[model samples]
Target chain A: MIQWAADVSMLVIGVSLLLSLWRVLIGPSVPDRMAALDAATANVIAGIVVFAIRDDTLDYIDSALVIALLSFVGTVAVAKFLAKGVIIERDSD
Target chain B: MSEILTSLLILTGAFFLLVGTLGLLRFPDVYNRLHSVGKASTLGVVSTLLASVVYFWAQQSTLSVKQLAIVVFLYMSSPVGTHMMARAAHLIGIPLAKETQRDDLKKRRGSVPANE
Candidate 1:
């Protein structure tokens, strides 16, 4: 039963990933792409967690944590760049 | 019994993830996409993480702090990231869909132009 659930969930995640990929590829604008990327990152984390459960191993959880932090930072930086046109700000304006 | 619960949670999470990505693909505007991805995907990921935490606790007889930490971090950050992205899209003057009826932000902020 556990294996059946995992297999089905994996298929669903795969479909989700593909849909996000399509959005990333056919972006009409930059922010759209960024949003898609953010969604993709979240999906990947979900995938990792599911894989960890299926494998019955706790090690992949660490990778999931790291990816979560990195993706948040990446999203914030990209949003900042989009808003201000520069990720790095200077004191002398 | 616990195994069944874990599987149910994971399957539900996967469903939400699929719904989120579907919204991302079909939404007509960036803001709408943000709304979809932000809410659905966050819930999806959180549910799945909770499942893993439960799974490890039940099967291995030990709690997984890392999975719990990931869930906490994601819940805290995902909404903030979505808000920032929405603000950025607005600052850059991304237009709303034709079906949009009201411009609440413009009404609230008046004629002040975006920071270009």
Candidate 2:
């Protein structure tokens, strides 16, 4: 059945998410950890799609978009901080 | 006609998502894994959204377009975000893998030695 297959696949995605969480926890450096977070977001996106399909609702899609956007901003801000030690600093010369 | 197309699109999208998950689990390096998840999963999610847009188009045209718009924004943003993060990581002096060679930035900056 299609439902069964999608469910199994969702489980696989969840497993991958656990792996990403592992990296987020054990990553030796900041970028590594942030990369893991990004991966987690991607997994969440997939999970959202799967949930939408299963529940037959479009609302989940909206949440997915929100998560995707927030994760983008969060990951970029964190990465910038790691790289330059500051996200943004206004001129005060 | 629409069912078949939607079915194919969803299948392909699922396949790509599966591959992205595999890459996330299997890849050793952070940057490499990002490449795996970023490119592969972006394509997968976008394709799936497009499929949903198509499916809902048959049922109710307006809603799917909203989903498509979300997909468009996501597609545009994901890559730029990933690349920025990767380059940021490099700039922050996160060491590359041991097998990596010929880092021109390192050479230009005189950070890495000549033999390396």
Question: Candidate 1, clashing residue pairs?
Answer: none
TM-score of every model versus the real structure: 0.95, 0.84
lDDT of 1 by residue, A1-93 (tens): 777898899999989998999999997988899889988988899999899889988888888888889999999999999998899888898
Cα miss at B103, model 1 (Å)?
1.9
Q: Best candidate per TM-score, number?
A: 1
Q: Least accurate stretch of 10 residues (summed lDDT) in model 2 chain A?
A: A1-10
* Reference-based lDDT, residue A84, model 1: 89
Candidate 1 error regions (>4 Å): B111-113
Provide i-RMS per model in Å.
Answer: 0.7, 3.5
Q: Which ten residues in a row have the lowest lDDT in candidate 2 chain B?
A: B107-116
- Per-residue CA lDDT of model 1 for B19-105, tens digit only, reads 999999999999999999999999999999989988888998898888888887888999899999998998778999999999888
Interface CA root-mean-square deviation for model 2: 3.5
Q: Supply the global lDDT for candidate 1.
A: 0.90
